[model samples]
Target chain A: MSAESYENEYGNAKNALELKNITKRFGDLVAVSNISLEIKEGEIFSFLGPSGCGKTTLLRCIAGLEDADEGQVLIGGEVVNQIPPYKRNCSIVFQQHALFPHMSVFDNIAFGLVEHKVPKAEIKMRVNDLVDMVNLNGMESRWPHQLSGGQQQRVALARSLVLRPAILLLDEPLAALDRKLRKEMQTELKRIQKEVGTTFMNVTHDQKEALSLSDRIAVIKDGKIIQLGTPEEIYESPRTTFVADFMGASNIFSGKADVNGDNNILFRGDIGLEILLPNNDKLEAKEIKGISIHPEVIGIALEESEIKALDSWHTVFKGRITEAFYQGDFSELTVKLNESDIELAIHLGRGIAHDKEIVSGQDVMVHWKWEHNNILYS
Target chain B: METIKNATSPQSDLVVKNKKKFNVEVPLYMGPISFLLVGFVFAPLLIILFFSFLKTGLYGEIVYEFTMGNIKEILTGGSGIVFLNSFYLAVQTTILCLLLGYPLAYYIARYGGKWKVLLISMIVVPSWVAYLIRLYAFKTITGTNGIINNFLMDWGLISEPLTMLYTPGVVMVGLVYTWLPFMVLPLHAAMEGMEPSLLEAATDLGAHPVRRFFRITLPLSRGGAIAGSILVFIPTMGDWLVPALLGGSKVMMVGNLVAQKFTIAGNIPSGSSLAIMLAATLILILYLAIKWGGKEAMEKLV
Candidate 1:
């Protein structure tokens, strides 16, 4: 795919190593669309998206493997659009552990040094030091096939890091590994990044992996960053429907919003509920447009008769339990509101389930605090 | 009864053993086929070895006069130079094939068009013509007044016919041309099988394009090199027709020597001895090549 959206915000700050209005196109397809991001020094930044979402393409563009057709790439405050990958002080670890099978582990790690005309003594010392860092001692004389899969990955890591590049780019480096090994490598990768003190830009589809390992995550959908935030912000305050779903599989309900008293939004239709949302300071009092409720905010009721009073300002829904699916500690219930076709998804902890143990087709009430929902504009 | 005891005992072990016994069909057929192959292919070599130790009597029958002198003479006599010449020619053919054929193979493997079968056919279909005929064709192509010389002369590019044919240089060119596709095909396969990510990783690690090739591509393609060299070298060493036809009866190689001894020299015992020595030397070269290649070569990694 291609990145072709960011083609004009062209500033070449060295701190940025920026992608200025960069766009990539492969004929009729757009892989990346108008992505502008500045990777700061010593930050473990991640480009996270689903498979085929063009995270890899963006990484390749930065590595200079694939050139940006519409914009410039600035490295060290100079535009490196014409520079080849080798001239850039960047190293990439591919998903597959692509060790040179003919060489010993030592030679494979020392390869960049040899290419750079490094002294033999320095090459030996550095390779040995990296081997130790990767915890692959005594494997210098071994061929690639002789080692296990994990060893091969470490060798690949050592091979890239031995060059001591300004930034390290990893293209799904854990993709080839088994589940347990992938987790281990992820931790090892983070540890190595910490030790090296180099900026790392990683591309991965594993959202959990990015959340856990990265200092800041750029959650991408169709190659555009849906949200750029820390792990806590991405999880707790997703800005878009895709980010909300992708980060943790949250249920999204779309509805129109009307402002009521004191920054509260009257969210009508499909449960006919109302929610109070944080008021946007820029918009005038009457300008807010849409409201959303996360699944966790909706709770199940035993019966419609349990409420002491009905308040229109704080909304509630009379619904029937259409479906309940137990997922260990929480049960996800699909509640059909009245005679409407709309389904309200409610997540219930085991401690706070419905009072009367409602089965499918049984009448129930769904309610939440109006302030617990979110207000959206545009 | 004994039948009752058998019926009560476990039957699963019998079934397992029966299945194991049923797996022998492959070795059963391979056993006899391997024997036939060995008998037909190796028996002649054994006969040659046996004859080399015996004398050909005046009546044209082998009189078993046991001798090691024949082996000594073949290994150390005037014929030794002929063996060296053959070795030199083969080495040159192998090197020339690598230099020209490698790039061709790499290009076709990486940038080959959709009509690969048709393209490779262009190289291979020419081989269907007789080897002897091809040698004669080359002989004509490089002759003093051949098509090339005539074209150059008619185009006013040269004043006179150049000495283009019937030399060692011409023979070298002919040998390389005939075996070039052999080198190209295997090397191409090796290159096509290679993972492009490896090259990318090399460059990402500060290796320039040329450095990447030497460090990653060359070493990875070593298996192809070995296979290609053997494909060209083995036949070129033994091929006497091409050299004799192209070099204009020049005393070209040990292959010519082997031909002379076997056909015209009237020395059957010496010819047999030299043939055995040639086969032995080939086996020795093969052994050394394998021993040096090591276990990393199990997957050719082309």
Candidate 2:
């Protein structure tokens, strides 16, 4: 579902969790400011931000690990602000996995069931089902230390999921794994969430992990949500330069906006270039301070003659290539405009930049389409 | 490519090399400590074992003749009562220490925050003073004319100074007081070493605070508890001074019996036999505790 619909799902029957103006303070420091969110039922939502941005604090508030000084937390349409973490049916997978070092995997997963006074026969059935679901069949008797990082992660998941929590809050659970394993667990986590149909709220500082896994993301900054949107919407149409910069690598230019002829809006960038925005109702604002465009959306033409020969529908500018980096699969060209200190980052395919000998200090032409440009508020 | 392979493969290669030399290297590193252990500890035990098998002269001197007289007499004699009394006192001390020390340890470990070091030092500071001096402080407190009785008498709360000292109950108090730090330190360390996320996970999984403590905190910190219990129990059992001084000559433990047999009675053979038997029993119990409690108990002792 889109982020708009998820936002409208607040206080409705379809929401699994709702936080209303939650604010948690640690003495003088506001760890989480006045924040409200509604996560749709069974949706994989993420609180994405840099470190110390209160994303994790907000998740902990929902889990009742930290008491918010001022707000209400509702789970399944029930106001559970006063409920203890144990009474609330929300399980959290810790960043460290936090598997019990003393207990075997089977016992670790069976602990919750034992606590709930579930029958022995049913505990065995549920434990086995979870062990199999996490792909820990023969490793049941292994202690947490015996398992690999990924295996320990699976056990942590099994241990929490066995309780059948209404929502699973994961605190950077995959941050410990290697790149390949992290990617694998990302898909594995999504698959398991689908199979179990539990609402998942994940907190992470890794932008790629958030972008790849979340159905919708809340980009938080300074203890407040800067933007809330689907992954594509957040990456493509960030509400502010902060959201755009935090979401991914983007070239942001400070500018003033003005309506031109017809329905077009022109942003007079301080970088000595005017970028055009096609007819859009959102662009009706009188003035805007910043405009953002993804680095990957910009194209670089090496030859000046080739740049001039390019047809319309392209807003082009000449700049000197100050730095060129040949990444493993792609290449990045940082072009400094001749008129100002502002540099536009243009990402190119490995074939274009690497196959051809591109170097710094060379003059290059940068261009992008009208629609790929986004106006940033402040 | 070769450099990349070499860099990546070195760790496994080093591990294999270390594994190959492990047997020889372990003993080499441990040789000096083992030598001291064997010389000071095992050699003394062996001498005691030899003395236990000897005959006693009329004047309590050691005789060269080999005999089982002392060993046989111990089982049939009133030594069983001494053992029972010592064990009972030790059990009480251990239980009292655990009951009193656990919550204190938990609070210091979990909630002491910036004052954790200060709180731990407070528990440890009393023990740093001479042992006898600390015991005497308890002695003064529990005496008939001690602070509590004098205060109560002055307030007309009692007709006379109560008989608060030199009793089995007073001895228990002394033992628990003396051994409480041993319980607190280990329990605090264990509680501090515990992964806080485990408790959070337990709470997240729908276990209440009490259930979390019983199922997670208590079970996980059991190593420390058992370690603390053993530390208090074993020492309290063998202690003759507290029972002799505080229990007044009315109570006697195995240590007092052993002390009397060697010094007052001058029966070296009986005392040696009794000491050996106690040592053997303690070793057996320690072995069983280590086996049952897993690696943490053994590690804590070391």
Winning model by TM-score: 2
DockQ of each: 0.65, 0.57
lDDT of 2: 0.86
Q: What is candidate 2's CA lDDT for residue B263?
A: 89
Q: Compared with the true structure, what per-residue lDDT tens digits does model 2 show for residues B1-302? A: 99999898989898999778747776898999999999999999999999999998888889989999888998888998898889898889999999999999999988999999999999899989987888788778878888889899899999888886877888888898888999999999999998788888888887888888888899878988988988998898889888877887878999999999988999888999999888877888788877888776554344
Off by over 4 Å in 2: A1-13, A259-266, A271-273, A276-279, A282-286, A302-311, A354-357, B1-47, B54-64, B295-302
lDDT tens per residue, model 2, A111-154: 88888899999999999999888889999988788889999999
Q: What is the lDDT of residue A130 in candidate 1?
A: 96
Model number with the top lDDT: 2
**Model 1 lDDT per residue over B1-302, tens place:** 99878886678677777877857788897999888878987888898888888776675456779888889887678878877888898899999899997777777766676866676777778878787888777767779988899999999999899887888888888889888888888888888889888888888777888777787878888888888888898888787877788886764676777678777866677778878888888888877776676444864433
Instruction: Give the chain A TM-score for each candidate.
Output: 0.80, 0.93
User: Clashing residue pairs in candidate 2, if any?
Assistant: none
Error of 1 at B202 (Å): 1.5
